[model samples]
Target: MLKTILHYINVNRWRLIKISKNNFLIYCSVFVGLMGGLAAVALKYLVHFMEDLSRNIGAHVPFHFMYIFLPALGILLTILYQHLVNRDQIQKGIGTIIFNIKRNKANMKFNNVYSHLITSSLTVGFGGSSGLEAPIVSTGAAIGSVTGRFFKLTTHQKSLLIAAGASAGIAAVFNSPIAGVLFSLEILLGEISIPTFIPLLIASATGVVVAKILYSRQLFHLATEGWHLQALPFYLLLGLLSGWTAIYISNVAHKLEKGIFKKQNRYVRAVLGGLILGVIILIFPPLLGEGYHYLQEVLNGNINVLQEESLFSTWLQHPLIMAGFIAALVFMKVIAAGITLGSGGNGGTFAPTMFTGAFLGLFVAYAVNLTGWVHLNTSNFIAVGMAGALSGVLHAPLTAIFLIAEITGGYILFIPLMIVSAISYIIARLSNSHNMYWHDLIHEKNVRPDKDYEMLTAIEIRKVVNRKYTAVKRNRPIKELYKLMAETSTNIFAVLDDEKHLQGVVLLDELRKRIVDGTLSATATIEDLMIEPPAVIEYNQSAEDVMDLFDTLDVWQLPVVYHGRFVGFVSKSNMLTEYRKVLIGQHHQPDPFGH
Candidate 1:
């Protein structure tokens, strides 16, 4: 019945497109935004419902012993679902989305639309200690990809819709439409032009509408008395602290995840990671789940919640001891997040990063207050620190700044936010060029978000290879080369050995020069006349790498070899021709409103 309804809608969609393609695209963008927003709303409610249920259950139990096993149980269930129901490996986080756009032609699997929503809900809802934002973004991207496929849209259109969906997801989550659009452009679709902004803006706005109508609760509230000029130096110090802390989180999470995954058995890893995470949460209750509730408390100047379920509640009364406790939460939050994900839980680092930043800011403000030299506005620092850490960790300063400003309604702190965010971003970038989402893709997969690289990635080297060139054995007489060149309308010839290995290339211009100079020798073999190519291209090399060879050597054509055997020649002209086609296709956006 569902399939029949979808088929009917799809058939009518084509008719609508025929009437007006621009209007159809706009309608499609709106639909994608709605779906993305609905998904975000559903995930948030489900996680909160689970948290409430867990709290009720904990109230009945002593010492909250359930904390010791809840995280592990959640992770185990996530693993089981993937192994049983999903039956396919599901890649988590924003990295997968970026990888798909770069190498997969923006074609995400259909299962992704629901798999992440289900798995991440179970993971985080059951206390997996990770954020819902990453899964939400992935789900949104999948929705756009699937919607495009359903309508049989072009790759460029599909990519646009994907970004639109992601933008909607972020907007829906935070009720910050501009930050959503910026997140998509800055973190997902890199190097987009002005023409591409329409769909993103429409989608983000639609998502915000959906969220406002369906979910009325704000994520965070800041009752800031505003910042003073005297606090500028402290904000700068907080920015530096946020930067160093961002680096610490990235490196520590990377190493911890590596260590956890080294264990071959997934169940054992989940149990062990869950036990460690549970222990950490038992001591630092704020580290449990997304930690947003505690973060709100911190923003509200309610620091006493840190000792609610903590083992150190007795000693947390002392100002110095409480400061140390906040500092410990700042560091342990990352470990809990790392364990949750590394142990097979499905979630993201966004919430955890913000959570840590809030605590770090609180700790700094608390310490400064203790010194009696000057008092600081703890709430302002908390809000700004969230932006600072987000900018430093994600390498998205604008998104972080706007997201915080919009969420807290604290535009008055824009200058401080900017100063801190920029400093933290600079400090973080000095040590690591890419954020956590892009680190593996850039270092291990060699995927980059640069326009040229993305375009080259889209064009396959095999499609542009010219195999029409004649191949003459190296031992063949030079006369055979002339005859072959005459029979074929080609300017280049490949000289191969008996084993079909590429020996060298014989250019028509060189042969013509020899003949014109009257220096041609009939007795000469192909090898004697052949000149070595400046470089040889492996058949499986990426187009970007091939372009690099062409630029570095300044050669027009290079011989392509497969397993040491001569295959064909790839010319710089063909590569650029393909690149131009991609460039044109990407920029040729139809007016969505027919204006």
Candidate 2:
């Protein structure tokens, strides 16, 4: 009765259905969507709490004195969680989500998700210099998997759920549904097919609606000025610089973190990060928090930028002071963000990437302004360059550009956004680390985003099933069947006729039963004992489709056929083992950290 109800739910709820045999896959996707929605809200609240706390404590307390304290606090909390939770996995956060969706896989462990949330919050909140995108993505993927599992979705449906969950998470956090949809297709699923696009759009839009009602958050408040269309050349220059900065940022963080991996103790490594950040913060409090306030000042044209003072200069040179100070701070900000990540902090590179792009834009604008060739607003350049640079480095040109547009609703910057984002993305690809944060993570884990048994769990039955037939006429002797079962060492055999139609299957235990009843010597046909109308597969089904077959059938083995001929059999062992492989080294093996 429960199965019938679930089948009804699946059939009605989901538009895309893979199985012609049953409506079970449909049910699973509905389950994934419902659960994913709820989980997204919870995770957002958790992230918000950490961000709020980070602001309050850093501002009120003397961060200089407490900078060392914050690092110790983060380390102690982490060690304590490691002790209490007894988790054997490294918390890669969003990188883990990207890892799962790269194939028809889902390892959405709730405890692991919780671990990521806590650790990543600590990483960013107290001056770790990372972004918040990591936790959001992890939580989103977890929501999807949990939902799919509750409904017992097929592998392909689960894959779609993973993308949906990721999209929903992005929408909830950023409050941008379209960006979420594009990200789901481009980054998560790697496909934007009509079938996949519809669900992604629905899920992302739903998440955005929820987020908008709750947060009402503003993306960027800057009003774009009249962009010089002829300044296209300058925009390309900004793109080149932004791409270099992004590559530099990625390289520094990855290299430093990798270098530290050769060292032994976790605490000591963390302490080193603390010491570096503390020294930097002693001079610059703006570097201590999320750094948004400082960025806000730049966007508002209110920075106390340092200008250069000549030796012969008289009184205070205000302009020179601002230039020197601003340039120096940008460089220090990079160091702080880099050191924070190198020490195994949990946050993401997303926010930091935007921050770095803003700084890069400031530098270019300052230099451009110095030349007196063209006028550029500090705020507009940073805003537009940030979108372009982020788009380029992340390789989601449309999403980044749209996110920038949506943030400020800037009509003038549209063409520049397009031109700059593409240029930056192209320039960043010149060196290695072409892919964004998680794409690079996939390589470190050595798991191909592509499909294979050792790689992809969803194995097609037609590929591995035995094509030979052991069935005979009902009058065939039981002794002959017994010999066949022993010789083949197969647990089941499909009975078929000369026309190649499925008859029935005989188990090894059945042959033993006939022998014990003294009917072994008699000629009996295989059809009399075989199970008729065995499960079949169309040739076009994916590995994910095959996995759904295993889930619905609940049998150890099933004969696969196309056009009424026995082709092969798929076993439960291959399916389960293949799926579980995703979670294997994900716990034990220590890979290089996220980009």
lDDT of 1: 0.86
Query: What's model 2's lDDT at 379?
Result: 75
Error of 1 at 540 (Å): 1.9
- Which candidate leads the pack in lDDT? 1
Lowest-sum lDDT 10-residue window in model 2: 586-595
lDDT agreement with native, every candidate: 0.86, 0.63
What's model 1's TM-score?
Answer: 0.93
Clashes by residue pair, model 1: none
- Per-residue lDDT of 280-372 in model 2, one digit per residue for the tens? 766555565456656766777755422111221232245555456556665666667666666656666677667767767776787678778
Candidate 1 error regions (>4 Å):
1-13, 16-19, 258-261, 473-486, 521-527, 584-595
Model 1, residue 298: distance off in Å is: 1.9
